[model samples]
Target: MIPTKEEWIKVLNEKHGEDVQKKLSAATVAICGLGGLGSNIAVSLTRAGIGKLILIDFDRVDISNLQRQQYRMDQIGEYKTSALSENLTLINPYTELCVHTVRVTEDNMEELLREADIVCEAFDKAEAKAMLTNYVLENMPDKYLVAGSGMAGFDSANLVKTRRVTKRFYLCGDGVSDVNDNIGLVSSRVMLCAAHEAHAIIRIIAGKYEI
Candidate 1:
């Protein structure tokens, strides 16, 4: 098993600088949806040396998703969780990851939270986020949950902001909206929100950034 702190930083410092290695190697994050936003978040976190990662996504890759998601055309039809988990392990062999290829629901919320130190909500559906948030607020008040909103267009840069949606939950995405119902996202907007989600997780772990 990889040591959560010292050993991780000692090896990771060669890839990330000292501060990033220290901050990220101490953190465990869940990228709950391996879609456009979740893909970016997981990639950045692995690169940053986040100690443990949890990937939860029931969806399969589609050609449409490849335009914004980090996965390649060859990965189509693969489960998002499995592909992302596989890639993350390849990126950093020492970093631990759990892959859950099931949708998050009130029924399995407890099961999902059991292994994670904090949760990240990358679901695109409003109902899923609401259910996940409600479950956390009612049953797991101590855990952290970070989320995103308004990231689907070229103007997504203007939308990425970090703010507390609740006491222990954070919202990271465009505060403003340019994502129409039919709008599509570029890699930039999706990745911007994703990076903010990774940063929030790292900050929470380092006792610096608060939800």
Candidate 2:
């Protein structure tokens, strides 16, 4: 049964308290990638009543992505941004979404992310993660950045963690795990790290973080 928009808002306010819900509803988060981590994080924030989301990705949903991505089988061959936006609207129709179908580059990064209250690093590639991290910290020093690293495999859920790297930077994940031969990203661990990034965004917006 699809709940009415007011019904969804009421549920969110009751669960998060009016003040936190308001904060969440006023924040805009920009997510760099729409793979395992970004997809999960986007769903979480949407369910939490985030006002707007900016999603960027150049890839489409593939069969191999079913293992950890939030996409359904029917979404195969669809762009990740489009698939995620469709799913997010189902979760919260009132939410606003801005999608970029192009790959993030140094030339366009600042313009793409300038309006966001928080920037989330959700790329699967290590180099992409590092590049986005450096660019955001250097150019958009005022924006809060929540990023994940080292979240791969199914070894230990507790290994996924969150830490405040700086006043405006937060890092999530094991900080050492990576996808490689014999080790791959499973939904459990990937979602765990994604949850940390989502929570960090909430904390920063809700004034629940110390740094």
Candidate 3:
């Protein structure tokens, strides 16, 4: 059954503790994709009671995305931003979601991520990841960027880990794996990395992130 706004708040506060819930309730996170990583990250963050979310994705849900992304089969063909918003709101009725169904580019990086306390990068392409990483580091210098790099295939979940690239940048996943001819993505491995990215955002917002 779906919880009402007040009931959801009570449950989250009890589960996360009042202090941590407060921190999460005041945070704004911008998720830059809605594939395996971004879709899962958005759900986790919402369940954790994050106050505001800026979801950006220009692509529509596809049949293949059902294997790992946070979309139902009925949602196929709908814009990812729209599909995810519906699901996330169901989890946390009080959470505010700002959707932008547009592609991200270096030219628009600043405008997209300026208000985010933490930027979660979940693009599928390596060059796209690098592009956003560099853009965030250079333009949104103060924003902590949590990105995934190596969660692919059915490799041991232990291999997936988070690494701090710099004071303002962190990479999650095996840090060496990638989806290829042999390696493929599954929900478990992808969600592992997404959890890392989501938790990193929480830590940063709570002022508990450590090098």
Cα RMSD (angstroms) for every candidate in the order listed: 3.5, 1.3, 1.4
Give the alpha carbon lDDT tens digit for every residue of 90-207 in model 3. Answer: 7777889999999999888889888899999999998899999998888777789999998888889998888888998989998878786468888999999999898888888878
Poorest 10 consecutive residues of model 2 by lDDT?
A: 176-185
Candidate ranking (TM-score, best to worst):
2, 3, 1
* Candidate of highest lDDT: 2
The number of the candidate with the highest TM-score is 2
In model 3, where do residues sit more than 4 Å from their true spots? 1-4
Model 2 vs. true fold: TM: 0.96
**Per-residue CA lDDT of candidate 2, range 73-150, in tens?**
999999999999999998788889999999999999989998899999999889999999999999897899999998
lDDT scores for all predictions? 0.78, 0.92, 0.90
Off by more than 4 A, model 1: 1-8, 14-23, 176-180
Residue 101's lDDT within candidate 2 is: 93
Question: For candidate 1, lDDT tens digit of each residue in 55-161?
Answer: 88989999989878878788899888877777777777667788888888888878877767788888887667678877887798778888887777667376578
User: How many steric overlaps are in each model, in order?
Assistant: 2, 0, 0
